[model samples]
Target: MIHITLPDGSRKPFEDQPTGLAVAKSISEGLARECVAMEVDGQLVDLNRTIENDAAVRLITTRDPEALEIMRHSAAHVMAQAVMHVYPDAKLTIGPVVEDGFYYDIDMQPLSEEAFPEIEAEMKRIVKAKIPVERHEVSKANALEFYKNEPYKTEMISELADGTISFYKQGDFTDLCRGPHVPHTGFVRAFKLMRVSGAYWRADQSKAQLQRIYGTAFFDKKQLKAHLEFIEEAKKRNHRKIGTAMDLFSFHDDAPGMAFFHPKGMAVWNALLDFWREAHREAGYVETKTPIILKRALWEKSGHWENYRENMYTTEVDDEAYAIKPMNCPGGMLLFGTRPHSYRELPLRVAEIGLVHRHEMSGVLNGLFRVRSFHQDDAHLYMMADQIQSEILDLLRLEEKMYSQFGLDFHLELSTRPEKSIGTDEQWEVATEGLRAALDAYGRDYLINEGDGAFYGPKIDLHIKDALGRTWQCGTIQLDMSLPERFDLTYVGKDNEKHRPIMLHRTVFGSIERFLGVLIEHFAGKFPLWLAPVQAVLLPINDDLIPFAEKVASTMIQAGLRVEVDDRTESLNRKVREAQLAKTPLILTCGGKEKEAGTVSVRTLDGSVHYGIPMQQFMQQVTAHVAERRLELDLFEK
Candidate 1:
């Protein structure tokens, strides 16, 4: 007999060679139908795999989280099979599951989006057939011989050290994979082909170019419908589209990925920076500026030349190599080393809004979200070991206060040490624990992301949610012990002996440009009065009332409101429509009646109109609203 321990710690004695499916069948027919895969001694495997020894097992049903990935993997195979059915000349390379979806790369003739319907129909036919997916192990030599016609598969097999390779087969289609897929093709209930793009074989530019098909899958038809709806909504909220419509920013072919902020865009940028400076001031931080270019020797000592050289741009100056700064930490380190410190000055906080450059691939260069040149709101803190936890708590509090100002909701994630990292194991443990302790003290639940930290230390990431329920990673706090050691930074201890101070690297806005992009989508270009590029616009009913409109605009501008005058020879309704399209918060109109009464008619973005408001009271109310930085407009409220 073989003993099997379940997830709930129940032991069941089974006869020799009992399979996971047999166990599920013994429990209940409904469970057996729902079970798509099983975990045998912590390793996910096919439900038909025989249990030969005593071990713990967990049956994965369709409702479990892991089941989705299993189903998606099966869906990828089904997609590949469907493509082969439609186009037998296509050669498969590889398929893998990505965040929220899956993709498969195949060498085939270039096709457009119009071909998606035919391929999808074939995929649905395969799923309805319910062909059983079987896994088998073959010798390496046999695998190479079996894939002799497939160059990509043969090349992959040549690199593997294992003597036996795994392959999954369904119906007349077979592929090379190490997978824990669903029991059959029918498990892929609902799936859609999202798009087709050009990709180089194995992601190498020199290799053969292939067509990559992207897709997503879900268990229920309703879930698939919801996902498609979200995608459509996101397309409508795209910052690039909204930014151009509002005339706030633009990108040029000459600059490639750099943004050109117009005068109106600069207004929004200045407001955000001003707010950041004020909050940092209250948090006891002193701001500083650093050089945009530094010597290559400095980066070598900081370890970036060895690990991050590919992403850096370099040039020769004065017979020496120099690099445009890709990060602000090394320069901040140099500044810290310029002066000696005492324990009394411990926990010293320094901030910088530095512009840096990175050579990002053209494929990933998004509008402002992923750019070549951007500003990072970086701050570094030097403190004693005992001050680590308390300082982290303070940083968390500051982050919360700043994000709340934007009306954004956020969650915490703790990322531990990465594989390609510096510092000793002990240092990494201490750094990770310090952040963990601070998060615990903050009284919020956080998720652990294994091996996703910075090169120097573990970190905490703040992912903020937008209005559409999508999360954006905007803030991070990393604890570093290696940089201090590398830079030989020191401070006098209480006993008058020198000691190395620990460093904490953090940023509330990971990139100001990216945060601005997030804000654009979060508010759908409808900014609050204070953050609006043009807070209010004045429209005269006719040419005769232009003087009164100009007078009112001057008064509002002097009162610190961003006011504009519509001096165009357009009708009042046309001017109002244009202003509304521009997302102006306040629309003020002056006519013969209002001009004679020393008043103006007020209109807001929400189509609310109030008549005959005195100019003086209007200016006062607008000024107060901006000064308070109110997220909502309560103007003309009784």
Candidate 2:
């Protein structure tokens, strides 16, 4: 008899080896029907795999969060099977699950969007067949012989150490994989092939180019429909299209992944900077600027040279190598070592908005979200060991204050040390516990993400949710003990002896350009009054009133408002339509009636009109609204 421990601390005795599906059936038939996979000793595996020894097990049903990944994995296999059915000569390389979806790369002829329909139809046919997926483990020698005809598969197997290899077979199709997929093809009820693109085999340009098919799967049909709707809405809010239509920014082939900001875009950028400066000033931080390029020796000492060499851009100067800074912490370390410090100044908070550059693949470069050159809002805090919790709490408060200004809601996550990390075990434990205690004291719930922290230390990551219910990883606070020791930084203690100070690296905006991109989509290009590039535009009722419109614009501009005057030979309706398309927050119209009365007709972006308001009163209201940085528009209310 074998004993099994369940999640609820219950035990069951089974005769000989039992599969997870059998365990589920012992509890209830409904559970057996819903079971998609299982976890044994905290490792996910196929439901049909037999349990060999006494262990703890938890059956994963379709309703569980883990089921999505299992289902998506199975969907990829079904997709590969479907492709083979259509084109027997196609060679498979890899199929992996990614964020929100899965994809498979195949060495085949170039495919177009027109081929998606047939491929999708074949996938649906396979799913409806309810074919069982069987896992087979074989010796490396057998695997090598089995895949002799597939060069990509043979190459992958040759690189692996000599051991048993796993493959999954469904119907007449088989592929190399180590997976815990869904029980059968029926679990993949709803899936769609999103797109087809070209990719080099291992991301090396010198390797064979292959066709990559992208897709997404869901357990429920309703969920799939809702996801498709969200994709459509996302297309309408694409920042690149809106940015070009508004003439805010542009990108040229000369600098493929770099953004060139126009005057209007600079207006929004400066406004964000002003608020950042005010918040940091009140939080007791001193700003600093560092060189954009540093000697290679400095990076070698900081450990980035050995670990991050591929992503860095290097140049030779004076017979020595120099690298463009990919991060700001190394330079900040040099600044901290510039002078000796006493414990009284132990909690030295330094901040910088430094521009950094990295080498990114041209294929993965996005508008502003994935750029090669961008600015980082970085801060380094040095403090005593006892001050860790308090400093963390302070940083959390600052993060809240800044995010709330933009009406953003965020969730916290505590990431533990990764596999290949520096520092001793005791140091990691202390740092991880320090962050945990801070979150507890702050009275907020956070998720524990195991093995995802920086190599130097454990950290707290902030994932902010935008208006469309999409989350972005924007803020982080990392505790580092490695850098201080590497740089040999020390401060005088109260007892007149030198001591090492704990270091904390943090950022509210991971990338300024990425945050701007999120903001554009969050607002659908309808920015708030304070953040709007052009706050207001004055439209003349006719060519005769052009002078009056210009006069009002001049007054508003002098009062620190970004204003424009429309004096084109166009009708009033056309001008109003153009202004609305530009997403102007306020549109002011001047004509004979308004000019004679010294009043103006104001129109808002939402098409709400307030008639004949005194020009001076209007200016006061507009200025107050912008100064307050209100999230919503509530102007001229009773």
Candidate 3:
């Protein structure tokens, strides 16, 4: 007899070994019908797999979060089967589920969007067949024999250390996999082939090129439709398209993966820096600047030469090798070591808007989001051991304030030490615990990501969600014990004894350029009044009203607002449309009626107009909105 424990603390004794599906049927037929997979002893497995010994089990149905991945994995197999049915000569490489979808790499004639319809139809036919999926384990010799004609599978088998390998089959199709897939083909009810792209076999460019087919799956047609709609919305909000339309920034062949900011874009960038400076100054931080090129030996001392040399851009200068800065922590450490400090100055905060360069792959060079050169809004806080919690709390509060200012919602993740990290285990534990305790006291939910920290220490990362529901990692607070020891940084304690200070590395905006890219998409280039390059534009109804428009522009400019006048040989309507397209916050019009009355007609971005407002009153409302950095035009009554 075998005893099986359930999530609710219930146990059942079976006379013989039973499959997970059999156990589910014993509890309730409805559960058996809905369940697609099972978890035995915390390991997900096929429902039809036998359970021979006492263990805890949980049935995974469509309602469970884990079911999506299971369904997607099954969909990948179904997709592979469909491809084989259509093109018998096609060779399969590998298929796996990724974020929001699954993909299969195949060695066949490159497929375009034109082939998606037929492939999708074949997948539907397979789903309609409702074929049962069977799992089998075979010895290494038998596995090799089964896949003798498949080079990819043979290569994969040679790398496996297990004596026996697993394979899954449905109908005439079979593939090597370690799966917790849905029970049968019918479970992949709603799916769509997204796109086809080129990917080198094994991700090596020198290897044979393969066609990668990307697709997504959902439990029902309604869910799939909703997800497709969300994808469409994301495309509309893509930063590259919006940035080009707004003429904010551009990328050129001469400077690939680097952004050349226009005047208007620089206006927004400077505004962000101004806000950062004010916040840091109020929080008792002193800003500093460091050389962009430092000797290679300095990086070796900081461990970057060993762990991060590949990403660095190095050059020879004065018969010595120097590297462009990839991180600011090392420079900050050297600055701290430049002067001896007493205990009174232990909690010193040094901030820098440092320029950094990294050698990103050409294929991954996204606009500003992934760039070779960018500015990091970085800071390092040196404090005593006992001050860790308080200092971390302060940084968290500052992070909250900065993100909230842009109306961005963010979630926290605590990442622990990685495999290639420096420092002793005990040192890492203390540093990680200090961060965990601070987050606990902050009274918010956070996730733990193992082995995702910096090379020197653990960190708390902040991922901010944009308007289209996509999340971007923008802020982080890292606790480091290695840099201090590497640089021999010290301060005199109260007892007149030299002691090492703990270093907390942090950044509210991990990179200014990337954050601006996110913000561009978040606002759809319709920035708020204060952050908008041209806060207000004055349009004359005719050339006769040019003087009045110029007067209004001068008044706004005097009030410290970014104002412009449109005196071109164009109609009022055309000028207004241009301003609207430019995403200017306010459009002010002055004509004969308003010129006589010393007033102006105010038109907002949303097309609501307040006519014949006194100049003084209009100035007051606009000034107030800019002063408060209001995201919406609430200061003016519509």
Candidate 4:
């Protein structure tokens, strides 16, 4: 008898060998019908695979995370089959599931949107056939011989050492793959071809170009519908689209990765920076500025040469090389090394709004989110060993306070040291323990991201949630002990002996440009009053009230409000519409009746209109709202 354990911790005795399919049927017909694949001892495998020993098993259905991946894998096979049916001469390579979906690489005629529909029709026909997917294991020699005529497949086979390879067959088509696919083709009920983009074979620029088909799949109709709707909604809220409509910001080819801050964009940028600076100051930070370009020797000494040289841009000046700073830490290190200090000055917090440049692939650049040039709201703390935990907790508290003001909730990631990291195990252990103690003191739970830290030390990363339920990594705190030692930074202790200070590098905004992009999407361009490019627009009913409108705008501007005068020769309704579309938090309209009475009509963005409020009271309320930096408009409820 073979012992089998289910995910729920129940054990079953199966005589001799039993397939996962038979095991599922023994549990329940409903389970057997729904299970598309099985997990055997944490590895995904075909349902027909026989188990002869004691192990745990999991029946993956349509609702599980792994279920979507399997469905996409099967869909890729179906797509390949469709391509083969249409063009038998085309060579197939690899197709893998990615974060959002899957893509199949094929060497054939260049693909266009025009060629997609026919291929999709063939795929639909294949899906309707409900063909069974069969998996078989074969020796590598036989596998190579099977696809000997296909150069790419033969090349791949030559790369594989002597081992068994798995191949999946559906109908008359077969492909080399490791799959735990859906039971039958009928399960691919909903899928769509998204786009056709250029891709170099094997992602090697020197290799031949291949046509890659991108598609997404889901278990059933509802999930597929929701995904499609999500795409539409995301398109509507895309920064590229909404930024132009709301006059937030723009990009030009003349200065790639450099932000063009329009008046509105500048207003929002200043608002965010002001908030960040205030929070940092309150959390005991003193800000400084670092040089944009530094000697390459500094980076070499900091070990960035061995790790981050590829992403760095270099220049020759005075017969020596200088690097456009990719990060601010090295410069901060040099600044710390400039002079000796006393232990009494230990736990010093230094910050800088430093602009750094790193090379980003041109193809992947997306507005402000991925850029080559951006400013980091960076800070470094020189703290004593005993102050590590408390200092980190203070930083955590400030991060929470700042993000909460933006109405953002965040997730935490604790990344451990990498394999090629500097510093001894003992040093790393102490640093990591300090980070954990701080996290515990602050009562913050985090997910471990193994092997995802800097070359110097482990770190904590914070990912903030947006309105659409998507998360962006905005706030971060990283503990580093290596840089101080690298730069030979020292401070005199109370005992009059020199000692290296622990460095805690942190950023509330990892990249200001990226954070701005996320903010635009999170608010859907409806900026809060304090951050809105125009806090209030003064609209005159006609050219007759232009003088009064201008006077009110001047008064509001003098009161430290961003007020705009809409003195156009347009109707009141038209001006109101413009203000509403502009997302101005407040619209102050003056007409013959209101201007004569020395009162103004207050119209907030949420469609609440209060008629005939005293100008003094209106100014007081608007100033109060702006000063508070409320994330939401506190307009009176209708």
Tell me the tens digit of each residue's lDDT in model 4 across 1-638: 99999989999998878988899999999988888889999989888788878999998877778888888999999999998988888899889998668889999988887877998899999999999999889999899889989888889888988999988999999988878788889888888888887778776788988889998888677887898898888787788787888787888999787767788888889988998888888877899899999988988999988889999999999999999999999989878888889998878999999999998767678988999999999999998999999888888888888889889999888888898888888889898888878887778688889888878888888899998888888777888888888888899998999988999989997899899889888888888888888888988887778898999888998999888898877778998998898888888878898988989988987788999888888888778888899877875445
Q: What are the clash counts of all predictions, listed in order?
A: 0, 0, 0, 0
Residue 270: error of model 4 in Å?
0.7
Candidate number that wins on lDDT, 3 or 4: 3
TM-score, candidate number 1? 0.97
- Residues 313-346 of candidate 1 have per-residue lDDT tens digits of 8999999999999999999999999988999998
Off by over 4 Å in 2: 10-13
TM-score of each: 0.97, 0.96, 0.97, 0.95
lDDT of 3 by residue, 359-462 (tens): 98776788899999999999999999999999999999999988998889999999999999899999999999999999999998999999999999999999
Question: Which digits, one per residue and each the tens of the lDDT, describe model 2 over residues 201-255?
Answer: 9999999999999999998889999999999999888999888888878899999
| Clash list (residue pairs), candidate 2 | none
Better of 1 and 4 by lDDT: 1
The weakest ten consecutive residues by lDDT in model 2 span 629-638
Better of 1 and 4 by TM-score: 1
Which pairs clash inside model 3?
Answer: none
- How far residue 609's Cα lies from its native spot in candidate 2, in Å, is 1.3
Spell out the clash pairs found in candidate 1: none
